[model samples]
Target: MMRYIGSKAATLPAIQSIIETHASGATSLCDPFAGICTVARHFKRLGMRVETGDLLWGSYMFQLATIALNEMPTFDRLTPTLELEASNESCAAILSAAQKVLAWLERSPGRPGFVTAGFSDAEGSGRRFFTQENAARIDAVRVQIAKWRDDGLIDMLEEAYLLACLLDAADRVANTAGTYMAHLKSWSRKALKPLQLRAIPIVNNHAQNCCSRTDARETAKTNVDVLYLDPPYNTRDYSFYYHLPETLVLWDGATPTGKSGVPATRRHQISDFCVRRRASSALDELLGQSSAKFVVIHYAADGLIRHDEILDMLNGRGKAQFADLKVRSYNSRVREADIKAHHRIYWCDSH
Candidate 1:
């Protein structure tokens, strides 16, 4: 959740009410620009088959944990491979297995590797996103997870769940104001605490779901009953701001370099919707190609793209309506003052 921006969890009630008003009968939903998969999880819980994706690996991990999973994986198939006892209850069994992994991580000594060198002060890196001790723990856990999967000890679903746990734990204790764009000059209270993994509430849904990691524009051709859109509200590139999470998820075996001491990535991946000039055109193009019976888009009223521009784009295709909703978005190190923000909920019947 550290890499989250414009998440729809806060505005779920208002957005869901509007969605039911127009798309109550929809059995299939697609969230093309799914940030943290809050929309997809909502529809999935309602028994709708949902497909969602984002370009970042961190978001995809969220998708794997929240949307891709149809039921809680108990690691029953791998219990022979793993030395943990399984309980009869499905959820309890899964947690036991996860706790087994966490226990190993807790006992293991911290390894000074990618995370320690890149994101922490282990090697005297200027970045202080994590302390030397915490960074080493992260590195040890991440490396062990990778080794477990590579050694055929865990399957894809189990790996994703465990990684999500690790990332979630790290995010809470990270020494940043909110994002990993820049570390705080001094460590915060949370950063000083020892690292620990809490159980991610396993959301078990019955409907079969799928997800992708690609440009939202590319998914417009795929038709669905309801399509949810949550694009970037400004020109701030996520690849640059949340590069640490992306790298952590990737585990590319690449070390940190350069003055910033961050991993290598295409940091210039700013979306067209984030740009002032191209935003209007991009919204029009995405909405224009959508073949859903209904489309729901969440854009900030004070975002780079104006509320009227979003309305015009949606109205061009069919009947459009909006709801004014207030929410608290992430406050960046530079943009800390403007923490409280509002979004215009735009829903349309494209058919």
Candidate 2:
């Protein structure tokens, strides 16, 4: 769930309330946004069938590794030998690659400069969040992981798990705030620390779950008991925020261009799905296609989609009810001061 954007951890109580109110015996849950698969994971733990899907590659990795662990291999089964060894040849190669990339980035124009990047606080040193050496090490690890995948030494599930862990570690050591576009006001000049990676243990089993990469509206055929809609709220696009990590995972050294081309792939553009007019059409399509008894749409007050508009849209179609769940969100990545606000969660039921 740590990797998903717009996690519903804050709205779980409300979500659960809606589920309890509407769900009958043996229910299945669907979260269209499905960032990090948190909602799907929660429902899975409760012995409910869960189906999660997201557009982002990283989001897919999170779901495959954490949420859809039923068919995944155990951590013990993945034994390709990756550990911190001062004399290991693989480690040496990784360190070397990182240094090269760092050197190249130093010449590029960007915030936080290359010399002062990393996740630690040793202020006053000209080092960056990632040392040239550390960057090389990470690059090397990525290479080895890819090799393992190609050789069938590891399955796609294991590869995604390892990649996610690496990304998590890199995120911690990065000098930027939570996002890559912006750096932290206070710079940290400490040497890059080693990243500890762990895989979630899989438990329980159910019928093989199904997933699709198609748009939410297109995927809604026959809804179950509960339908959880958690779309992006504010204009703060997720692709921009997590660009660095994405580059590392999906980096082909394509020479980034425009807002989405270079280091950050502007793949998850908010404009594509954030407009109010589009929301109405999408919602109507979703409701029209869904056969569920209850619909729960999680929205924010600060979003481009208004609560009144959402209620009106839902009200026009069925016997819907709206409940505002006050949620406090703290944005560590926002350029401005940490954002603290109350968001409304709308629960609409159609009998």
Candidate 3:
């Protein structure tokens, strides 16, 4: 339910096949631009140690829940506080406790707060990112999460998991397309549905996975057998596309501005890869910093730095090969014909 602009879910099978064919001996992988941690989650299930980093706080939360945590959080301290019944099966007990918390949150009455005041049409804000009721619910849940963290009721992993749940739930009812660049003038069918928080499946790979908030250039240097890079494809800034989730996680109460109702501070989260002039240079810098024995990169054929240029760059590091995965083009203007595009994956063993 966590929508993304360039999710690799569809291309994951092909990428994994290519990696297993070429770099089967790899024991660890790092995804510096781990949007939603989809790639990291797959590789983690394959018994590879994972490291993930991203500029967006929401991405970091997903990584924390899906990659970094090796077991379900027991919520041992909070269990007694909630007066929940104990179970002989530890894992089941913990998961049930988490679900109970989520159910309680869902039952809480909605309250108009920061999110409703800024991101909803309530009080004539004019923005329609979410309905007034949903916005108030979002506000109430978000505030409760912060309160839990402050009251020592949840740890970092627990906090991230809850926030990830909220992010996914909120996205389902949002009035935007895949991205939050703009909202529909009229309410969409999906947006009319009530928000429901659900628990995510926590991965237990038994490997020490690391996640952090850092630039790709910096995290690429981490020692790993394989490094996966999925940078921004075009000039569209992800900060703008995903500002709602970013703001929701930070909960800084920053004033929203412009037609999109994004906070002005979101400008700081823009990446160099979104700038045409700096895109190529950013890739080069990240490649140079990476210490991984194998490097796998995903880029669009018509991305800011063309796929040919990306191949050439990879070849310079070592022997390189590529696979072109066909993707359905999302251009609504060209409805007369089925347009398609290629998402190219380049993998190489570093010299």
Which predicted model would earn the best TM-score?
A: 3
Better TM-score candidate (1, 2): 1
Measured by lDDT, the strongest candidate is 3
For residues 136-163, what per-residue lDDT tens digits would candidate 1 score against the true structure? 9999989988887888877887888878
TM-score of each: 0.89, 0.75, 0.92
Instruction: Residues 122-201, candidate 3: write the lDDT tens digits.
Output: 88888899999999999999999999899998999999988999999999999976677788888989899998989787
What is the per-residue lDDT of model 2 for residues 129-208, given as tens digits with 9 covering 90 to 100?
46554555566666666777777767776777767666765666665544555445554543345433343444444745
**Error in Å for residue 278 of model 2:** 2.4
lDDT, candidates in the order shown: 0.77, 0.59, 0.85
